[model samples]
Target: MRKVAEGVYRVPARAANTYLVEASKGLVLVDSGLPGSENGILKAIAKLGKEPSDLKLVLLTHRHLDHIGSAAALKKQTGAKLASHPFEKPYAAGTLVISAPRAWSLYGRMVRKLTTLEYWSLKLFRIIKFQTTHVDLAADEESVLDGVGLDGSVVWTPGHTKGSVTLFLNQPSVAIVGDLLRARRGRLVEPLLMESISQTEASVKRVLDLDPEIICPGHGKPLPASKVKIEKRIVKPVVVAKKKEEEEDLEELTSGLF
Candidate 1:
């Protein structure tokens, strides 16, 4: 766990939990820790001597089960605003995207219990009816919550997921990159989940061009600017699905879990 800057506490747990708990606005949890690590997050926050409710925003880089495992639980307890990219909303809302046979095996049959890789990493939710105040941010657009603690633009970085995002600061130039990078206990790309292999390659190059001083990856240790090397050129992701269709999925993911 690396503190990129003051008030920005980066906590990477077993699978790399990145929480950007701030002081100005409140606690901005970049990505909620794993389900089992929820209470630990609370304790760690307490250790920092920051009020738990300072937690305002819970920005999800992508909608993987590990990333959003305890998101609903945290929102209920802290009333934090759970922000996510339009692409990942559906999976987070508890409607697992069970891939078709071959795709399912390759991607992850998350709907079935004890099947998906994340299941081994974290136990599947029985009810998974956790609730939160959802906030969907656009990929091309930038969301600046002034009064809130979060002070950065959300950039769309697909590859791991079509709508995967990265929160970057203009000053510190620290990026809270989700599964887009490998930095924690494990060193590899996001476990076998891919829509378009080409898109993932493009997104990796996109973050490098930003020239961020700090690289806050989703699953491992954080790297400094000098550590990140662009293996390819940056190219804007070609969003495959229609915007309207993505919006509907986003609403359902954030609104309710049926």
Candidate 2:
């Protein structure tokens, strides 16, 4: 819930995670977790010595129940500005709509059905005791969340979802790759939400070119870049990182120090 980097964090929630990106003005919340998460997020914020005004922006990695189940409620309660990729706007507005992906799987079929359940929960979350919110800040392909102190853009890394995006931070190479890339208990793996392997692999390579210093994801945990050293663990992305000089630094200083 607090800033782990210049303005990035992997906030823990009820079996899920919400990220907080802090900036000069305040902090930006990324993907508010399930209905009752705001309380924990708010408490975490308070631990940072920030008030309501400190929460300036609220961004979503995508519009999944576990990811943004609290978007609308947070806006109404915290008054934080919401921002997301245009592809994710409809989802936040309570619009459950998306084109069928090129690939389909039994697992995806099950997860896809959760949308209806999520919608009902969103309504119940607001009326009952917990709550959710709509996405107010929607951005396109190269949007910058300066409020989060991110001098980069949100890349369209679909596959997990049409709107699945990754925040590409610059200067020192940091990428906030949501569930698309997860490191479970320090072991990285391709997530279970993948809609198409082809698209997911392609999107990963796209971000690898940046020589990302660290990859903080929506599941598992953050990749310890300083210790592990690499953009992403995917074979293709790592291969791309090794092949391209733009990402030559991806090579870890292997001297048995790690």
Candidate 3:
């Protein structure tokens, strides 16, 4: 884990990233990495001169496997409260089935094709699934995390998922974005695994509105917010009504247990 700001540390856990926020009372972890990632988190915390029990809260940006997998274990180990948007609470509780939105672009299609194989294998063999845990619900608004020892708030930035959110730190003007965007070839790229392109665009605009100086994505290196130019390269939503044939083809191609 490396400190990106005064009190924020970023740790890469496998393909995902986890962040630690040193607050007045204790540490607040953002996105508990993958399952079996507690060891790494502990090591990272140790580097900060802290321990697992120092974690007072684990805030999830969304309820994807890679984000929420280690949540249960972390909570159990640290006795920290778990918080997330109400829409994502069910997913974290293991009460809702997890599925990705269908891809429409060639790049999206190809990436999905490669990722779905791993997803299918995990599902088919029941290799890994998030453990059921109690979660406290937080509103999709700013200042939600104020009294929780962190110097930031969680903003609703839905796009990658309905309950996706971004953590905005006041002092450093940094945003801990959990897959709402990513770094592609050193440039900021909005996530392709999206439920709605329009909503994703809106969320990106919301993040931009904060004028964050540093962006810590869930799956890639931290990017300077200035490098994330969304206006010129925005991806327009596909007009489904005008592409019935293409829709049919996509459905046929992705109909299986993807």
TM-score of each: 0.71, 0.72, 0.88
Error of model 3, residue 179, in angstroms: 0.8
- Which runs in model 2 stand beyond 4 Å of their true positions? 1-3, 97-132, 141-144, 147-149, 225-258
Q: Put down candidate 3 lDDT per residue, 123-195, tens digits, no spaces.
A: 7327655476778657454444665656667888888889988888888889998988888889888676677
Ordered list by lDDT, greatest first: 3, 2, 1
For model 3, state the Cα shift of residue 228 in Å: 0.7
Whichever of 1 and 2 has more lDDT, that candidate is: 2
Q: What TM-score number comes out for model 2?
A: 0.72
Q: Per-residue alpha-carbon lDDT of model 2 for 157-243, expressed as tens digits? A: 886677788877674367777767777657655665455566777777777776787887777677754333323434454334334
TM-score between model 1 and native: 0.71
When 1 and 3 are scored with TM-score, the better candidate is 3
Model 1 stretches with alpha carbons more than 4 Å out: 96-123, 127-144, 147-149, 184-193, 229-258
RMSD vs true structure, all candidates: 8.8, 12.7, 3.4
What's the C-alpha lDDT at position 38 in model 2?
A: 76
Poorest stretch of ten by lDDT in candidate 2? 97-106
1-258 in candidate 1: lDDT tens per residue?
Answer: 456676667776535576664636777777776565567677667877776686777788776656776777777777777778766777676555523111112123333223544554333444443333355443334444554745567778887677788877766677778877665333333323455446666776677778887777776667775665433322222232224435655998988865
